[model samples]
Target: MTETKTIQKTFWQKYSTLMISLVVLVIYGWALTGLTFSGIQESAGEVSSSIFHGLTHPDWAYVYDGSGEDLVSLILQTLAIAFLGTVISAVLSVPFAFWAARGKNEGKLHPRSTTGKFMLVLIRTFPEIVLAIMFIKAVGPGSFAGVLAVSIHSIGMLGKLFSEALENMDHGADEAIYAAGGTATDVLTLATIPTIMPEFLSYTLYRFEIAVRSASILGMVGAGGIGTPLLFAIQTRSWDRVGIILLGIIIMVTAIDWLSGMLRKKLV
Candidate 1:
């Protein structure tokens, strides 16, 4: 009887807090949202109907027409922007990542200098679309503006990723190089870079894939890419042409995903 009582007490002790917490959360949510069983049913019905209609087949005739050129050009331009942006960002991120990693430097300076940290924060805080718009205004519409926009945003993103990778690196190699009286540059070349190379390449390629998609959209703001064609098609109410553009985008993005997946598999 004593053992049975102890077990019962333990079970309640472990679960009582969780049970109470769940009850409180549910009550709070319902009170705040004013949600009822009827509301849930209504929402479910509306969502189901909307989703059903949205999935209907697109116009097929556009695929055979020559209107696909705009989409094809937009896609190519977007790819070009993404590719250039990623390359520029990768190049710039390397030095920043090297400086940001701890134990890689024995100086009085912080692992990430105040300016560097602030710049990274600033770059990350702004949306890439906003940057693209701003650049479009400054540089006028074209692939170059899109590339600059993506590059700036990518630098912030990749810098952080590269820094984390560097931090996780083994200290032994860097320490050994320093002990051998190697300079910072020498140590970075001989030890830090080689160790982090695979991760760096993998991240860069992954960013490239994302940039390609983003570039297409950036064209909506007059930044050059397939987005321009898409916008034109939509404005003209040319659903047939829109269909072609959508199909091309789908194919291109899928190809990029597949290629990147294969590359990542080899890298990792």
Candidate 2:
């Protein structure tokens, strides 16, 4: 009886978590089914043809946009928003990350405590589109709004990753610095930053890739990017134009992904 009980316990320990996860997934799938479009079957044939045709025959003329400002230029705008946003977030996240990182101290006001965690969570709760809309109201619809939206969203992400990197840094040097009467700023500047710089760079590059995609989507909301024109092309049934814009997005994202991946491998 004892042996049988032990076997049963082990089996349950191994499979109970999986069973719960399966149950949760089933429930979510059922909910999603209810939310799915009921008319998809009716529209799928026509939609498929339109999409297929558009993708196959993109307008090369729109690819360069005649005089100079074209799909490429708009894509460059998207890249600029993402680049600036990532830089801004990377710079701003440092202090928040240090505050959020777990350290030697403990208790409510201790440096080791997660006092900044709540703030980070709050910031991340709002999606980039929502933030873009808000910023559009504040700054008007343009690249500025897109930049602000991406920057704010990037901050939450960078801060979380940065804090994790800080928490996992070599404590020996930091302890020595503290013991030698070094200030928090000194330790961070000299020890913490150096130790985590590689990981920080890797995360920043990854975030920039995501920001590029996000910048394009934010453009759909009038935040300023190729998305506005892409939307217009779609609404006007200009599939040729849509194809050009999509191709531009695909090329830009692919190139950035490749470069960032290479850099990350070298750094990390």
Give the TM-scores of the predictions, in the order they appear. Answer: 0.75, 0.87
Query: Which tens-of-lDDT digit does each residue in 126-162 have in candidate 1?
Result: 7778998898889887888899999999988898788
* Model 1 spans > 4 angstroms off: 1-69, 104-115
How many clashes show up in model 1?
1
The candidate scoring highest on TM-score is: 2
Report, for every candidate in turn, its global Cα lDDT versus the true structure: 0.80, 0.89
User: Candidate 2: where are CA atoms >4 Å away?
Assistant: 1-18, 21-29, 32-37, 40-44, 66-69, 107-112, 177-186
